[model samples]
Target chain A: MTKNLSNVNQIIAKYQGDQSALIQMLLEIQRENRWLPKPVLARLSQKLGIPISQIYHIATFYKAFSLIPQGRHTVSVCLGTACHVRGAPRLLDRVTDTLKLNPGETSVDYKFTLKTVNCLGCCALGPVMVVDGEYYGKPSAKEIEKVIANCD
Target chain B: MKKLQKVTLTINDREVTAKEGMTILEAARDAGIYIPTLCYHEKLAPYGACRICTVELSRNGRSRLVTSCVYTVENGLIVKTESPKVIKVRKLLLELMLASSPAKAIQDLARQYGIEKRRFEADKTNCILCGLCVRYCSEIKQANAIGFVGRGTERRVVFHPEIASTVCASCRECFSLCPTGKLPSETDGVCFDDLTLDDFLKTQQSPA
Candidate 1:
């Protein structure tokens, strides 16, 4: 319990515990821990004077937050108009086959999370597969497999 | 002497007056203006979930659609309960309601607006997330056993996994208010108590 308190306090101090910074604090915690633990969220609610239900509402309202465990790599395939016309669905299938995950699901090994995004605003890079910060444009099966092997 | 404050506004090009702190819906109803709504109840607090009571407000020429159930009255607020834009928003919302539940209540409401078919595929989850049941449980019964869980397309009204059993046995106020409720028979909470992740998956597997 003391360890949890100190960990939460360290995070709270990093942003000076601003009320408006709750979302950002949750995001940073998600990045570090790969998910928002219930205990961590409770600590945040207590420290921020926010109701746990409200915090849960906010966390669930946004697509960015995840309460359950997440994989190390966030892999997203664009299925927007441009990507669709350029064969984004097939590319998504190939990536999913390589990682053994379906859309809106993470791999059992916790290495990669496979998801489908509407658009990434980079239509020029049609058929885009974003593995975290790295964007792969028009990637073929061989390229996706290589990317999968490279994933930690 | 404490006197009630009064406010006047123009709704649908007709001058209407109402007391201050009254919602636009109440004022419009008093003025005999017909505004469609689904998630509103007189006994409970205003819930803008259904978005069917949206109206166009043109205050100072900045027109925007606002839900009448929650938007309060202010003097000089130009309200259009059946403006073209307002109708369009209501039509979209009704189609969504149709998608959620095709019960007689939903169908009867849609038929009033000449809506016979749904433009989009019916999700068929049957529960529209109106929060009527949740609100009734909390406010009237003081039982917080049910609430909104998850997010986005994965969102749904659900009994809290741990608390739905003991507290919800005798409470059926929400059931009466639910547009598509079919649970809580004489056994009471027997169905909701067995809600597992598998049940959630089964609902998700249904064509949405």
Candidate 2:
């Protein structure tokens, strides 16, 4: 927060502080910071001349932005209709038990953040999980555990 | 001046005439029919959120369920406000909403409809993620302080920490519009456990 406020300003300037670019701006902020801090959002709102509430609205509307600190590796289990039908629930259970964290919660040590997504748009690869933007299709419990172990 | 054109439609078993622009819900109300709604407000613009006002429409050899609050009337239209299919869908929606908030007002309404238990998993907390407060702030007060964020099951009402930290006590307009009392409090207000029927009924109509 002490230094990234300026970084957020640079991203806002790159977007020309346009109101319509709010989503992209936040995405960039998330890209740089991995999660959106309240201070960065306030600074962006001030620079962009948009209401803070409206900015929060946009931030919350999208699943990409995180309001709090996120783990280095994010585990999103696809619970979409296609994945669900293909046994995503079992994958989710296995992942959560191994990670010792539930959806919407980061581990106490911040090693991982687990979440369940409606779909990851890879229906053919039912029961998928993504870690740091890398997709693992048809992941089994032992495979998911090994993947997380290697993420450090 | 042009006369107001009327559309003749059948609601339930009775023939009713309503203005061409009037919605089916309004037309049914004009014909003395009752339709439960969660998001409709006379003051704010129509938002078809709860889907409880859904009714079946049959015309031209086709039948479909449309939310009466938004769907308009047409000539020779047949409407069944309480069709079995409509009830089944409404019950499902109500169960989902009940799982989220379990508000007394909503529970009473559901009980009247004979719904007993939640059929699906409850994935959310109170507030039901309805946008009534967000809409009230934006449209009515123009405050832009709160809003709905995310999509699908992750959708929820989010507040501006800076603004909400200070302005909540002074401005409570959204409190009334929120069907679930989760907003505006960590305790007290319309939260089910905060008070009882006798205390609440003292101020408003008793649902029981």
Docking class for model 1 is incorrect
lDDT per residue for candidate 2 within A1-152, as digits (tens), equals: 67799898788788777889989888888988778888898888778888776876677667787777878888888889999999988888898788888787777677787877787788998888998889999987788889999999
What TM-score should be assigned to candidate 2?
0.70
Fraction of native A-B contacts kept, per candidate: 0.14, 0.46
Candidate 2 lDDT over residue span B1-208, tens digit each:
7787989999998999999889999998888899888888767777888888999998788899998998988888899988899888888888888878778868987897899887777655586655788778778877666666555664555565456556655787887777876765533322223332223212221111
lDDT of 1 by residue, A1-152 (tens): 46655777888899898989989988887777777777888789788876554566677666677766779999989999999999997898798788877776766778777778888999998899999879999987888888878877
Clash count in backbone of candidate 2:
3
What's model 2's lDDT at B133?
Answer: 82
Chain B alone, candidate 2, TM-score of 0.82
Model 1, range B11-108, lDDT digits (tens) per residue? Answer: 98999999989999999999899888778889889989888899999966799999899999999999988888977777777788788777777787
* Candidate 2 chain B weakest lDDT stretch, 10 residues: B199-208
Q: Highest TM-score, which number?
A: 1
What are the candidates' interface root-mean-square deviations? 4.5, 11.9
